[model samples]
Target chain A: MAHLDVSNVTKRYGDTVAVNDVSFSAKPGRILGLLGPNGAGKTSTIRMITYIAVPDAGTVRYDGRTVGPWSQQRMGYLPEESGLYKRLRVKEQLVYLGTLKGLSEAKAAERADYWLDRFGATDWADLKTEELSKGMQQKVQFIATLLHDPSLLIFDEPFSGLDPINAELLRDIILELRREDRTILFASHRMEQVEQLCDDICLMANGEVVLDGALRDVKQRFGKNTLILEFDGPDTFIDELAGTGRVRVNTRSAHRAELTLADGADARSVLDLALDRTDELYRYERVEPPLNEIFVDTVGEAEARRMQHESVTGTA
Target chain B: MNMSLRKIWLIVRSEYWRRVRSKAFILATLLVPFGFVLVAAAPAALGYLAEQNSSKTVAVVDQTGGQLADSLAAVSDDQLTFRPVSHPTDSVRAAVRAGTYDGYLLLPDSLLTGKGHATYYGMQGGGLTDQIQIEGRVSEVVRQQRLRAANATKGVLSILQSDVSVQNRTIQEVGTGADHTFAYTAIGYVMAFVIYFAVFVYGQYVMQGVIEEKSSRVVEIIVSSVRPFELLMGKVLGIGAMGLTQMVVWAAVVMGVLAGAAPLLALFLDPASLGVPADASSTAVAEAAGLSIPPVPYALLGWFILFFVGGFLLYASLFAAVGSAVEQQQDAQNLLLPVMTPLILPILFLAFVLESPDATTSVVLSLVPFFSPILMMLRAAITSVPVWQMLTALGLLAITFVTMIGLAGRIYRVGILSYGKTPSLREIARWATYR
Candidate 1:
């Protein structure tokens, strides 16, 4: 059974439909990347799932039951923005959030200590949140999101404002939580991180889901009809592939080029064409498209269409 | 939709404990009333001390066979003393110049003939106590002399003397008032202002609490756990608890100061200065008249708490709503002004209400939801307020309190997550009714 099932949830603010007919479910112990643009209804959908908002015309269920204290207690949410009391001590803030999520004060404090130490933020435990640097406060907020030992965690752009070292630390911690079978759902614009960490993905554009499935399945759905050529000689052979009716040269440099084959075309033909002209062909290979490319490919056309509509309506 | 008891309790506990532990709450609660008392007592104490430091000796040249000089001596208290001098005004003036006498007075020959024949002179001026004493004693002496000459003093015992002391009875009240002007004014005004100040001052804490949560963006996480309505209720009730605690502390401190200091201060103040007679005849007359002390307006204090709490919650709800709607304290200030406008309007007509507490307009204003919390208690203090009026004001306040919380809850739920800038009045009104 799904740990969280948000079905046909719709929300509106004024005349703006923040989320329309949004439906998704996350299996237990699997990470689902909720992908979206800035105004793509990710936060609104997350809010509805957590019961911060009730759906205008849908239902949200957790563990086969409706969202309630039972679900809210087991769920953790780290909003993209900093959500902390500036004047409150880091340890106390963590403990307060923990207790609110249903831990006892003693348990919350104990977990806060362990997390603070794990994050190498023990020195900041006694300091006020405002006294800490932005990165340090982010780490503290991250710790608060974990202090209750929640079964499910929703992180909205959690890696934002994090330094590289801290981000690496967070990446490792997320992997560990995943190993421990915690259901994780994160929304972010960072495609590389999302592609690397997410087992499943749901991409949103303009308050509606455009693509969603298992990460591998979604990638497969887009198909990887492409080839990579690495050589020392001029890559002008890629220009010939561009001339061919069945292939298009995606890029060409001094020693390398990438080519995408049209439907009913073959990567072997593109690779053969590249090798025939190259005096020193180091390598020729076929490869799947990166998630970023797929994301841009799918979302780009949607964006272009939106622009066209906006132009026609003069609403831009 | 799920507002569990534990969640609300947790929110309330946090809000309450955070403020109650602050040093500002402690200092303001314990010291403000003492400061007010110091302001009220400083001048009277300075005058008493000034009189104590300067003792006056006035010499009188009695042209009426020393009768007026002896009369002045008979009435002199410790503040001023009189000495009969066998000399003219010039000699007395010379003594004043020598600093042996602080001042002098002369009694003319026609002093006993109902003509104003007594004149006072001093190097500095007439003393505070000396002038009244001398005039009183001289008039008594002249009247005594006239009665002796007319042989009309022997039959005075046969005259029937009666005194009527007006005992103020309230038509439908538990307490009575003695003619004590001090107690009436003290109780009424003190209760009125205390409630008025707490409703605004503590109400600010509620507003600031909302602004703090909103500005810091912490409310988003909070609302995710507890409903915003629950969060708002917890906050308002928490601040209300703190306000009540501060009020209790202040009341205790004020009551203690009044208890321990009143007797000590009474030593320095003159009963006669307060318009009550100090002599035995006046005492006998008062006893004969049976003048009762006014009932302490203290009983009406329970009513004061009722209005104060009702008024507090009402104003506090609005303040919290404004706090949530505004992104900054400066914006909250603009909103606070209009919210406080209704309170200011009544103060303009406060004098009339105080003068005639039972007046039609005063009674009507006292029942007006916003004004009643302050104005009603003030009016009730001066005169007996009808039970029905008190009930009506209390009833209106209760309804307004519920309505305000409902309205503020709507605004708070919708506005807590809003950011970037202050919402306009129309925007706030929309939030207040947002479903």
Candidate 2:
């Protein structure tokens, strides 16, 4: 059974539909990327899942049953803007959070110590949170989230203030959690990070998921229209070259040009023709579309369609 | 342990340690005792030192050459050196304006004729004490002159002094319960003001704590793990514990100081030698005058802990709840007024009821749980309070404590995550009713 299944969820903030008909399933050993633009209903969905706010419509299931107090016990959440008491020491704050998550005093203290050591923050045990830098505070917050060893974890923009090294360190730790067969849901706009971490992805736009699937499958589907080319001279050459497919230049330089083989353009045949035109080509390879491009294309297309419909209805 | 119990303990620990260690709490706790000592002792200390080191010069301007000046000299504190001024009244005013003299008194010519009125020239609003001293001297002169004219004997003066004498004491046998000691009354004032102060200090600590969490959006993360009730209770209890610990330390310090200084107080204040006469009529006079022995310190201390904790928790919970309900400190003012009004009314009523802890006053203040702890402590200090009444007031207070927690929790649950306009009373009511 899936560890978490949020089905047909809808939430409204007064007249604003924050989350609209959202559905996703996070199975054990899987990291599901809940992707969205700012205010794109990702927080609303997470809030509903955590039971911080009740869903106006839909059910959030844990295992096979719907969410309940028992589910909340095993669920860990790191809110986007959460902070520790400014005057409280890092270790004490984590211990308090551990106790709140149902750890016994001894267990909480033990876990707090372990997490501090893991984050290389043992020396910071007695230092108030206010004394720690923003990156260090982020590490403490991360440790607090995982100290309880919750089966299902959700972190909203957990990498915000972290430096690259610490961010990678946190990423490795998240991957380690995934290796332990824990179900994780992370919301981030960093596509590269999401691509590296997520097993499945749900892309939310305008309070709705425009696209969702296994990460590899989604990338494969998104790859069909994109192509890469290597040739001498400028990109204007490819734009003028007639073909069975639409030619969109991906990149152009003094010595080489890259193109997307839109629709039916055979990459090898197109390259063969390009070879006939120039011989200075070094290498040409087809690669999967970057998640950022996919996001932009998908959200852009959806928005354009909406605008067209709105204009017809005089609501533009 | 269950989350509620664990969270509450955590909260208590958090509130206790965080606030107790705070410079603000330390400053506030120390402010009260220091303020009391300064207000009570500064004037006496200053006056004593002034008498020993410097003479208070008084300028006497006599329009008529009478023996009024001589009478004024007789009433001097020995350190008060009177300077006779034959100059115009304007000169005396200039001297006073120049700060040369504390004050000047102009005696009218008809002073001996019983139609005399004294014109005191100085800062009109200022020099009240100076005016009082001068008045006392003038009255003594008038009395002496009238007595001499009427040819009154010393027996008459003796009779007048004896007729107006007041002797006061407590009528209790050895130790029925205990007389309302001045010490006990002091404890009441201390306890009342302490509770008043501690509740605000600790409650504001809890309030600010909640506001910090709420404003930072940290409460959403916390409330996910713990119930609002546990969080509210934990904060109040923790801060209240810290306050009590500080209070005990301060009390111990005060007791130590008093114990070490008892002999000095006896030497200087003459307290042990200060006693009413042993006549039955004097005792009766003492009883009628409402004089009593000090309140039992141990009893008052016990009540102090009870009422202080109960009083602090009752208010602190509401304070925390209010903090949670609002996103900003400015919004908190809306919720703050209703909770504070009840507590303030009791404090304001303390003055009027101090002289008369009548049934009406006692019943009115004591029945209301908000006023009960402070008012009941006062009544208990001044007069006998029935055990049944105490129990009833305590029980009602306990119920009030529970009810406040319940309501505060409801508001806390809804308000912790709420932002923008402060919730109205109707909205809070709905939250309370939300099952």
Candidate 3:
């Protein structure tokens, strides 16, 4: 059962539809990646889910009840443009946010200490936020989100500022939260991170969901029609195939090429043709398209549809 | 619309602690009272120094050839000693130039017709106090001489020379009361100014606080857990409490300084030296000594707090709305002028309110919610205000503030999340109308 559900939610700002009939859910013990390009309504959807904003239409439910102040206390949201009070100490900042989330002062302090120790930030707990490095401040913000032990967590672009070491640590912590059966909504335009961490994915474009389901299912639905060829020699034959409309070239380089076969084109024939043209065919494989390709394809298709609709309706 | 008081309290506590611990808050809180103390003490200290330093001997060269010189010499005090000089005018002038005398007073002979003028020649001119003392003594001596020549009896002369002092009293329902007009005016003006400053400054602090949160992007995290209205109220209330704390500390400091300085000031000031009439009542003498400390108007203070809180909250919510609508403090300037106009307009009418508290203009202005905090306080301080007027002004202020908070909350909820160019007033109004 879904631990959090948003159904038929639509939010409009002035004449622009920021979120149009968006619907998605997060199940316990799984990470849901809300994937989108910039201005694709990912933040808007997260805002509605967290109750920072109310949907203009439809409902958001948590634990089989409409989301409200109760759900707010039980949820932790790290906004894309989130920050901490620059003049407040790390521990105090966490404690303040914890208390706002319904923890007692003493309990908030204890949790703050525990999280600070967990993140190896206990030494810098006394320092003001402004005194810390950007990565350290990001760690502090991450701790603030977990200090209340919220059942549902929402993080928007959580890894934008962290170094590799700290980012790895954050990834480990997020995985641990999943192990504890906490639902997570990770919203980002970073496709690689989403591919690595998300069990479920909801792809949005132009304020509408273009693709959504289990990550495996979403990939399978696209099929194994992509031909990845690694060869050293003339790649002129690959362009000839693309020009003939039998395949679409996604990427082309000196020694490698990625091509998506047409709807009825045979991957085996394309491979045989590639082998004949190349001087040395070092690698050849037929595989499903990567998430990056799928994301671009869907978003591009959605944009084309929107432009069509706008042109038809005489609206820009 | 589910609001949590606990969350609001948490926000308030954090906001309050954040500011109260800042070095700027501490400096601003303490510096104002320190300035007040310096202003209050400087003039009295200077007066004491001048009194100690001014002592001069003046030669009374009475060319009138009457008992004028003798009479002036007999009436000399420690600060100014008049010595009868028989030297010629040229030598007297030479003596003065040689520093043998501080100055020479020449009483020209005019055959008791008062046609010739009296002149004082000196190396350096005396201060105004010294000049008044010497001139008064010369005039009195001449007047006494002429009065005696006119056959006036001693009793008649005494009556002619004695000063008449008037005592101002106010009649009330209970009894007649001593008038402390000067003290009341001083306190009223200061209180009005303090309220005006507290409202304007603390309102700006709210704006700055909102801008800090929005610019820093912390507002998103905060609003997620707390309703925007709750957050807005918490900030306004928290900062208002901090301002009130500063006011309380200042009030205590002011009272302590006044209590400590009043006696010290009385010691330095002598009523007789100040030229108070010798035959005046003891109360008049005490007043002239500059030692009167009027009783604190507790009732007026209670009213002041009510208005200050109402006025601060009223402007603070609007300031917060302005803060949320803009990305930076500079962008808030155009919006701030309208919010600030109401707070500043009352100050312009402060003089009129103080001048005639019962005047219709003063009454009407005081009743205006925007102007009540300043004008009403001034009017109440200067005169007895009708209970209905006070209640009506407070009522209007309460309604306006509550309404403003509601409207501002709507604007703030939408504005804080918006980033980009500053919006216009029409856009803000449209935001307020959002469900």
RMSD for each of the candidates:
8.5, 7.7, 6.4
Model 2 C-alpha lDDT per residue in residues B285-338, reported as the tens digit of each score: 322322322335577567667877788878888888788888777877877888
Off by over 4 Å in 3: A301-316, B1-3, B47-182, B266-273, B276-293
Sort by DockQ, top down from the best: 3, 2, 1
Tens digit of per-residue lDDT, candidate 3, span A46-156:
888989889999899999998888888899888877889999988888989988888888999999999899888899989999999888888888988898989999998
Q: How far does residue B381 in candidate 1 sit from its true spot (Å)? A: 1.6
Range of the 10 consecutive residues with the lowest summed lDDT in candidate 2 chain B? B264-273
> What's candidate 3's DockQ score?
0.63
All candidates' lDDT scores?
A: 0.77, 0.74, 0.86
TM-score of 2: 0.72
TM-score of model number 1, chain B = 0.65
Score every model by TM-score: 0.75, 0.72, 0.82
- lDDT top scorer: 3
Tens digits of per-residue lDDT, candidate 1, A40-129, equal 898889888778877778889888888976777888889878568987889988888887887889999999999998988899888988
Error of model 1, residue B293, in angstroms? 14
Q: Comparing 1 and 2 by DockQ, which wins?
A: 2
> Can you tell me which runs of candidate 2 are displaced by over 4 Å?
A10-17, A51-75, A104-107, A229-288, A297-316, B23-31, B55-198, B250-293, B296-308, B345-366, B370-401, B419-435
Model 1, runs deviating above 4 Å: A120-125, A226-284, A301-316, B1-3, B44-186, B261-298, B432-435
Which candidate, 1 or 2, would have the higher TM-score against the true structure?
A: 1
Give me the TM-scores for chain A across all models, comma-separated: 0.88, 0.87, 0.93
